[model samples]
Every structure is written in C-alpha cells, then in structure tokens.
Target: MARNEFRKSQGVVPFGVGATVDFENESLMSAGLDVWPSEKAEGAAWLKIMEATQIADGRLARRLSSDLKRKIEFFLSPTEAPELTGFQPQQQPGRVFMPFVRFPNWYFCPRCRILKRIAWNTQSSPNAAELKCSNMGRRVEGKGDPCGSLKISRRPTMSPVRFVVACENGHISDFPWSRWAHQNSDKDCDGGENGSLYLYSTPSAGLAGVVVGCVKCNSNRSMAGAFQKDVLHRIFPSGCPGERPWLGPKGVEECRDKIPQTIQRGASNAYFAKVVSSILIPPYSAQIQQILDRPDIWAEIESLPTVDGSVEPFLRIKAKNLGVDPTLSFKQYESVAPTARWMQKAMSCRRKYVIAMMSTRHMEVLGRQSLSVTISIRREFPSRTIRIGSDNSSRG
Candidate 1:
C-alpha cells in the first residue's frame, strides 16, 4: 500500500514540477501541469502572478504564459474548504490530487540486492505501480562459481537507488550502470541492453560500500567518487540527452550542458525555479489595482477625458463599480488614475512638503574624494536658492 501526503512548506521549493520526491521507499517525480485537475487549481492567483511577471519582464512572462503556456497551480487541500452544516454544495470530497510518476525507474531487491530496471507505463497512475522481488522463490544457477546453483527463499521490499545523472541545463537521467561496471575490466556484458545488474553493499560505510555488478559478466564495480562533477562525461561520450522525464516520455530536448554531472536525487542544485516578481507601487494598490488589471476597466478609464482633472471623476465611478469606499476623500483616491495636471500639481506640493520637512533637520557636510553638501536651509528655502558648487570636489 502507498500513501501520498504533501506539506505546505514543500509546495514552493523541492516539490514543484519536475522535482523528484522520495516517499515511502519510492522515488516519484512530480508530474507536469497537464495532469492537474482544473477545478482544483487556483486560477486568480496564477493570473495575478502572470500579470506581475509580465510587468517585471515581458519576455519571461510570455515564456511562462504563452510560449510554454504552463501555469503554476496552487493545489487546494481538504482543510481549505469550509464545512456548511445546513446546506450541501454539489462538490466531491475535499482531497488534494497531484499526480506523480515513478522516476529513475531503477529499483533493487533488498533481499538479493539484484538491481532491476522496471518498465512502468507513464500514462498509468503511480498508485497502480508496484515494485517487488520477482527473484523470490526462484532457482538460479551461478555461472562459473564454486556454489553452482542457489534457491531464492526470502522476499524483500525494493528500494530506489540514490544516484542519478543530471546536467546544469535541467536535464536528468538514470546512471550508466553496465558501462560503469565494465569500464576498465576486459569482461564484456553478454546480456546487452537487458543486462541484469545487482547492487550490494560491503561492510564499509558510504559510497565505498556500494557496489554495482553485472550478473551476465560477473564484473562488479564500487560506486566510489560517483558524485564527482565530470565523471558521467567519461562514461557517456555523447553527453546529456536532455531528457525531461518529468514532463513525460516525449519531453526530451537538446541540452546545453555537454557533460552531465552525477548527483544524488535529493541534491540541493537539482532544480531551480526561474521566477520574476514585480512590486506594484502607488496607483496599483488593492481595489484600484484590481480594476486596472481588468482590460475592460482600463480601456474605459483611458477613453475618459483628462481635461480639467476629469480623470479623477471617471476613476471615482470605476472605483464605485469595483465596490471601493465612495466616502474616501480626494487625498485617499488621488493616486488611482490621476490626470496629468493633477499629477504635476501633486508632485510639486509633495516636493515643497519634503523641502519643508528636511530643512528642519541638521545637514551633514562630508569631505571625501567627491564632496557633497545637503543645503536645505530654513533661511534660504523661502527664496529659490540653487547651490551649484560641490562641497568636496578635491581628492585626498
């Protein structure tokens, strides 16, 4: 039996799309956005994110919303739904559904330590996928060994290998097993692509303890220095195939990183989300922003006359349509689509106010390589005084 659970903290960093999650002795990859149910996904927040990203960087925004067209979804959990006592809505049971597929399809039998790569149907649900020790209760003949034949008695649960190959350009694939085992040795694997590999640990502690052996050729190799940077490049000369298994079987692309780096599944640099954020200032606050974000409202606002500060009157009407407080004074509502004349007047007034406030504070004059002085005087401010001289123009 398998259980699926998600933590709120995991949604942002490690558990996003293309991320590999090791859960309950299984390594599963977070599926692409296409698998997510539309009703369960949050659209408004995503739209806002797209808008904010567009405002920050148009190219990146287009890539996210138009080019890839993959929207970031916020999955709703059971607790998020409010319980109505008297009434029942036409809704199903509240449980978040996020589809995950088995990644790095390799698994090892714990009892025999025999490494096996299982062919899992990507279109099927991960819940239906099961890993077992098929070698259990089977008689196997040991070739060219002192112990000629042996019978497998014990049945043990299989575990996913910790090792995987990845590139800097976000492409990941299974580690080269047969190639690594027969790398330096003269023994050639007879099983070819379907070669049976076994992963057994010695009495030693870390990677030194781990050994990968081919059943066909009896050539075994220790997993020493497997986590090194450029080790996989020596094994696979063609470099990273740009395989994006998380996106699906057909998600392969041309990768820029010629040589793929070997890393554990839980490595920190495995996945990096490129996100752009925009901080809306002044006129784009709360209710006003909501209205401005709407193309229809903005179009109407732009079409309205700006003569004699008439934009304020039109904005007030739009704000009312958006359910904004009608009782707010001119100062409170001034920033929302204010007219050009009003903007100039407001800026002038604010500059005057700032000059008045700063003139009262003590001005510090510093002499360095480049000298500058704060000349806001209570005496000289009433009169228009523009000091053009630098305070400390001489170098030390």
Candidate 2:
C-alpha cells in the first residue's frame, strides 16, 4: 500500500499500470483491465471501476493513440445514450480500466516472523483459520514464545513482511531469507529439507537488532547492513537470483545486476513504471485530408501519371467530387502538407526543449551540479566578390 502522505502529496494514488499495492498481506501489481474477461472474473474483485474524467489531463490525452483518443473524446463529449432505471446515464460515462497482477497469498506471524502461505479466501473456514509457527515445539533459552510452548495466533495477528529484493533493472522478488542466513563462509546449508529458517527481532526498533537464522545449521546473519548499497552482493557473491515474483512462480530471468534489499513496499525506489508516449497530429488540409482519410483515393492518386502529366487536373477533379472548391490548385493543396510536417517537427523540438529545461530546473531547485552542454553551428556563405590581394583578409 502507498503511504497516506505520499498519496496526498501526489494528489493521486499510484494505482495504475505497474503500480505496487498491498492487500491481504501481499504485494501485487495493477494489471491492465483490457486483459480482463468480458463475462467471467478470473482474479480478485477488489477493484472499484470509476469514470476516466476524474484523472483526465490534457497533456496525457494528447499522447494517446488514435483508438484511445477516439474513446476518450467520445466519453468526454456530450452524447445521447439509453437511460436505465435507478441509474444516471452520465454517472459512469467513461471506461478507463485499471490493471492488476496476481500476488502470492503469504503472511508472516508477528510474534515469530516466520513466513507462511495462506488461502486466498478464508471466509469459508473462519473458525479454523490460524497461522502456526513452524518452530512451535522448538525449545531454546530466551527463544520461542514466553512459555516456550506451541504458539498459536489469530489471522489478524499476522502481517505480510514488507521486505522485498529488487535490482537496478526493476526486477523485484521476495527476500532470500534461506540463502542469506545459511549460505556463508562458515556454513553452507543447501536450504534443502533439512534447512529451516527463522527470523528474530529484538526490542530495539533499528534494523541492527533484526536477525535471520537457520535452525538446522545454527547459522545466522544480522540485517544491519542489508539496506546499504551493494551490501547484498558483498554478502552473496553470486549476485541477484533474478527472481520476478510478479510474473508468477516460473518467471525467473537471468540478471547480473546488483540486488538491494528494500524494507517497505511503498518505498520511493521500490517500483518504477516504464512508459512511452507520443503526440498524434491530424491532417491539416480539407482537400488533401479527405484524400488521405480514404486509402482507396490515396492509392489512386499515387498511381496517377507522372511524366509531364500535371497534378492540377487530378486535384480539381477530386475536389469537385468531394464537394470541395474545384478552384483549389495543386500548389495550394501541396503547401498544406508541408505545414503539417513542419508542425510535427516543431512539436518534436518543443518536447525535447521542455524535457531539457525541466531537467536543468530540477537540478537547480535541488542545488545539485548543473550539467551543461555547448553546441555551435558553423555556416559558410559564398562570397559575392573575392579580393585578389591576400595581404591579411584573404584565405583559401
């Protein structure tokens, strides 16, 4: 779940595509609703669909594709639709679907901090629902519960551990508790059936007091430097495990990037959504625009005679047929195409300038080192008159 302060400051909750959200003791991604079923529901029904007008931005709308542009335009524009009883026709005018990803139904007991998988739906067996620690019967000095007996807790007492392992390439997965605790210079626990791991937290609130240990090999490691940069690589020289839990159980990839431990799901560096957007420009001229709108007419125009055959006749004929002015000359129609082309080029240049300006402004605002680049354009013009004398000003 995103922090309340972050959501408030952002003025919008980060619940769109590639967003990480916590629900039912699990971290999940918001999948695109376009992949959802039209009739039957496959995943959880926790999403609340709303109108797209709430978060609509003109800048974002300008970047939409033709299909999405048409849909959003239709929704925002006034149009008539059939009215139904007990429902306002304009209540939910738009269809902007939210994306979601499947999350593992796992939980950790607060007292023991041992990981456990639970069912997706616990309402059916409410009376039998409980998380029991694996080390319930194990006895050690100052270890286990206060009585050192089997520990049982209600479902509410368990919460999902907020820790997750992430790489610089944006791959995220559950923390490697078994590998971190067992695989070390002093101990080489294979994490097989014989290896069992447990987490312990001291009275100190800092991460220095947190510990992970393997019960079988008696190997333990502290969480003190886990949050430090490149510390995981130093501890486990094998590099990241390339785990992508969001993609499911078998979605592992080959990644050699440094993996860092993140303590909270809502951390600023936890998830980064990669998006690419474009601005769509419409045709400018009504005469050429009409021809471009229909592929058949455009193809016919391309197939016309080219050897000294004037395009004015074709333009005039097409313009007359399309109810446009027959007086529209080829020169007038041809000039409109370049206007649109120049507009597109200008838009591209403006976008680049805005991005560079924003980057410079951000560095200045944060009092960081300002990166500057200098570019010079040299042009040579033909001299109208050349001096024969080469005393000082003449050069080859």
Candidate 3:
C-alpha cells in the first residue's frame, strides 16, 4: 500500500471488491461482496444508476429489479458508546461489511520451505483478513530423505504464491500447484491432486529460481516455463473452469474462453472494471427531481386526470415546490407538457443519442448535446422548465 492510500477510507482502496489486495504479512486475498446486509438503494440517484447500468449492459434488461439490488451497498461503521450510557456498541452481522477470501491458498513457510494449503470453505478456516503461516514443522518423510522435522521454537509465517490463472472472460482461479509440482515425472504421489508441496526460491535465478516439489513423491520442477502461453494448456487440457470467487462462494458462470493465461496476483491486467456514465434529463434532473421524488407528490401526480386543464391547477400549487414562480402564466405550459410529457420524450431521445454516441466509441462527447438541448428547453419555456445545472454532486 502507498502512503497516500492510508489517507483514504476503507472500501475505497484500490483493492475494491473482487480485486486481490496484499496484506502486511505478505499475504494476498481477494475481496468479496458481503450480502448479509438488508439495506436497499432508493431515491432518484439509485434509479439513475440502475438506468445507466441497464443501458450499459443489455443482459441486465431481463433481470428483475430485486436481483439487481445487490450492486450498491453501504457499510456502516461502529460509533463510540455515549459517555453517560456506560454501554459499548458492537458490530452487527448485517451492518454492511466486505469479506475477503484467500486466493492461491498455497502458502510456504520461509524457514522450513514446507508448502501448505489452507481450508477455504469450512467454518474453522482462518479469517481471510489475516492469514499467518501454519507450518508447525511437523515431521514428514519423503522418497529420497527426511522431508521435514518438528519445530524447536516458534512457528514461521507463510507467504502466498505469486502465480494465479485467469481468462479474458473475467474468471480467475488458483494456479495449478499440484500439477506443476509433479509434472514431467513418472513417479506417482500418495495423493494425486492433493499432495504435500514445497517451494524453494533462489532470488538470483529470478523466476527460474522458484521451484515446486511434492514431498510425498520427491518430484520437483522449476517454474522456468510457467510464464509460457501454452504451459497451462499442456498441464491441464480442459481449460479455464470459470471460477468467480469474488461474487461469493458459488458465483460460477459458464465461460467460453478456455485458454487461461498465468499472471501475477499484482499484475495490472489482473482485473478491469467497466464503467459508463449517463446524463439525467428533465424529471430526473436534480431540481425538479426532488419534487417528484417525494412519495406523496408522485402519488398525487400519478392520480391526476390526463386532461391538460387538470395539470394547470396542480402545477400552480406545486410550482413553489419546484422553485418556480407560482404566478407564471399557463401559456408556457404549451411547449412543456402537463406532467413533463415533452421532457419524457426528450429523455427517450437523449437515451437514443447516448446509445448512438457510445456506438461511435466517443464517450467524451456525451452530455454536450444534452446540455445544449436542456438550455434550449429552459429558454423556450422559462416559466415551466426548471433551470438545471450540470453539477449533480448532491446525487450519489
């Protein structure tokens, strides 16, 4: 972590959910999104976010609103207990928190060089936030000589292996440790895929210095060809398994890309986030949005008759709520619709324009045309159109 990263709040760090983060103990873990919290996103801001997401991802169009509710979340921090109350506040399970799962669970103790894999699924698994070396220097035998002996003193800290496999489809999984350790040798180990592994590294040799061995069979192989594009394919023919650990324990999806390339956990291309921004128009804009955002006001507007004359009375009474002069003539309402019908049409047009702009691959050009159109609307119907500014900082 950098010195400036410490100044930012938690959850805002580069280790954002789904990305692996390096710990102080030289451990690496991927952040997971916690779903125990009951908080749901509401108000116009959330609607705008959902709208943008829907526009960006067509697959989400068929997804129910409830299913898409998991995207936005807020984690509440515990506050100090009141002085006079003499009570201590405790953290709750549902109080939005992010959980981490240790990826590349294979860890090797520096002192003993004994590699170990930690249990990730069980309740007794070590906390993902903090993982320590579990090597107790237990006695073990190998084919050639004594593998390891009991420790005389304190246990050594374990460090995570740097290698992990990921595909272009955003699926990531642990590196094939057991396969790499026992490959190229004819000897069979006591445990086929689940065998005791050991790691030895010679810094002077760089990547070639790293070597993985099976303690049971005494088979060892250097990581010389590990970085090759076809090394993983040669080891395992099936291809990527489509593992998505960051979405939770069971977030697997069917991925078409088979060739997963080996990459370091801290590599720049390890993860990428797709972000798209959209402009809110008319009734969704900040100023007028607040008035319609009110449940009572929305319900009243929805129940009103469709007749144009019916809106004049409601607008006269609600004009003050929109920060407009209540005494304005009804003549301006000709250009603007009763219930912002024209604004709704314009909003649809803006969506089409935005989609066209995105198809052109020019995102920086967005909101330029919308701003000019908004200004024209404001000028044409000054009494009806609320002067909306470009700044939506107040929105989430």
Candidate 3 stretches greater than 4 Å from native: 1-17, 26-95, 121-130, 136-154, 192-195, 202-204, 255-257, 281-396
Candidates 1 and 2 compared: the better one by lDDT is 1
Clash pairs detected, candidate 3: 133-158
Q: Please provide TM-scores, in order, for all candidate models, with all chains considered together.
A: 0.54, 0.46, 0.54
Per-residue accuracy of model 3 over 46-127 as CA lDDT, tens digit each: 2333232222222232232234333322121111111221222243222222335666666666655676675444221123
Models sorted by TM-score, best on top: 1, 3, 2
TM-score of 2: 0.46
| 214-234 per-residue lDDT for model 1 (tens digits) | 777878788998877677676
| Per-candidate local distance difference test | 0.51, 0.42, 0.47
Which residues of candidate 2, in runs, are more than 4 Å off?
1-13, 32-106, 117-157, 188-195, 234-238, 260-263, 273-396
Model 1 residue 53 lDDT?
Answer: 16
Candidate maximizing lDDT:
1
Check candidate 1 and list the clashing pairs: 371-392
State residue 381's C-alpha deviation in candidate 3, in Å. 20
**Rank by lDDT (best first):** 1, 3, 2
Off by over 4 Å in 1: 38-96, 120-129, 136-154, 190-195, 278-396
RMSD of each: 18.0, 17.6, 12.1
